[model samples]
Target: MEEMECGIEKKAAAMAAAEEVGRKEEAAAGDVGLKELSRKLNDFAKARDWEQYHSPRNLLLAMIAEVGELSELFMWKGEVRKGLADWDEAEKEHLGEELADVLLYLVRLSDICGVDLGDAATRKIVKNAAKYPAPSKEGA
Candidate 1:
């Protein structure tokens, strides 16, 4: 879990730095081009001395850990976390950082496996909408 959380932070720092340099001209290359993204992921890991720590097994475990951390924000508290009620500025910032952590590991995992997350997510949303379309409020 710690490993995964660390990886996410690491990736985000690199991405933010890249943005500062005007490297990413656009949001990911859309549906067809992820080659460069994967390469960047690989290079980022290598440069940080993290490649040795990121086997498929470790990466998978880390991804799950990151998810667990995200869940911890509300696993039992339910919607309290989402409500942002009673949360101080620090807590809000912490929450934002943790959520970003989950997203980072997710994107990294997809890159490692040569998967296109944006496309995959869009496809899943379409399938899910078909399977479970909006409930009819009129039925009430």
Candidate 2:
């Protein structure tokens, strides 16, 4: 069944990517929430007749495979950390590109399932704010 349509702007996506994460309370750029990204994903899959193949089970596998490809960037089993931490200037850049491959699949998958990662993260933060109640040095 076709899900409810959400208007996610590309400009919003760019803005969110550009915005600083540690800044003060903001409107949350990248208005293109999970639902929006999913819609885009749907289009991509449909064009290639791939949606029929994207069962919940298979989607999980695809995600895993892409993740493994990403992991190849740092599978030295040596002193290196999980990512490009050990590499010099040139290799680190190569690792960065590999990381993008992993993220692209994740984004596509999230888009297919209507997962607005940013919105979801924000909502979770709000929930945590109420539950955790951070220790304030001085009462406001």
Candidate 3:
């Protein structure tokens, strides 16, 4: 009985450690922001001499194309749930890639246009909240 208790305790400890590591990884991933992604995109373009081709119009067009690709993935899928519960790994990965492509182009476009995308987005969110306030509990 003592040995069984020790084995269970070891399993619980291992599970707890795994959960802690997963949390730490999630926190680290959350640290990556638009600025870092923008910088990486800029460096990638510069290294390949593609910066000249990344004009605002060109980036915008590329982003739109990526959006089309992303939309195509859901075109026939009739309303997917929030968690994409039915998506296979390959489908989800493809969706992620298309989304990332759109974001990268948008970040690059914003950089070329001298716009701080993060700050602009933050201000837009504030404006939207002010423009469209939530209903009060009293009203409900």
Q: Highest lDDT: which candidate?
A: 3
TM-score of each prediction: 0.60, 0.51, 0.77
Clashes of 3: 0
Superposition TM-score, candidate 2 onto the true structure = 0.51
lDDT, candidate 3, at 135: 85
Which should have the higher lDDT, number 1 or number 2?
1
Candidate 3: regions farther than 4 A off: 1-30
| Model 3 lDDT tens row, 1-140 | 99999999999999999999989867886587999988878899999999889888999999999999999999999999998999999999999889888888999899999999999999999999999998889966
Candidate 2 residues lying further than 4 Å off, grouped into runs, are: 1-40, 77-90, 131-133
Of 1 and 2, which scores higher on TM-score? 1
After TM-score superposition, the amount by which residue 137's alpha carbon in candidate 1 deviates from its true location, in angstroms, is: 8.5
Per-residue lDDT of model 1, residues 9-108, tens digit only: 9999999998866644444434424455566667888899898887667788987888887777656664574468767888778778787667666667
Q: Please identify which of the two predictions, 2 or 3, would achieve the higher TM-score against the true structure.
A: 3
Model 3 worst lDDT run, 10 consecutive residues = 24-33
Highest TM-score among the candidates is held by which one?
Answer: 3
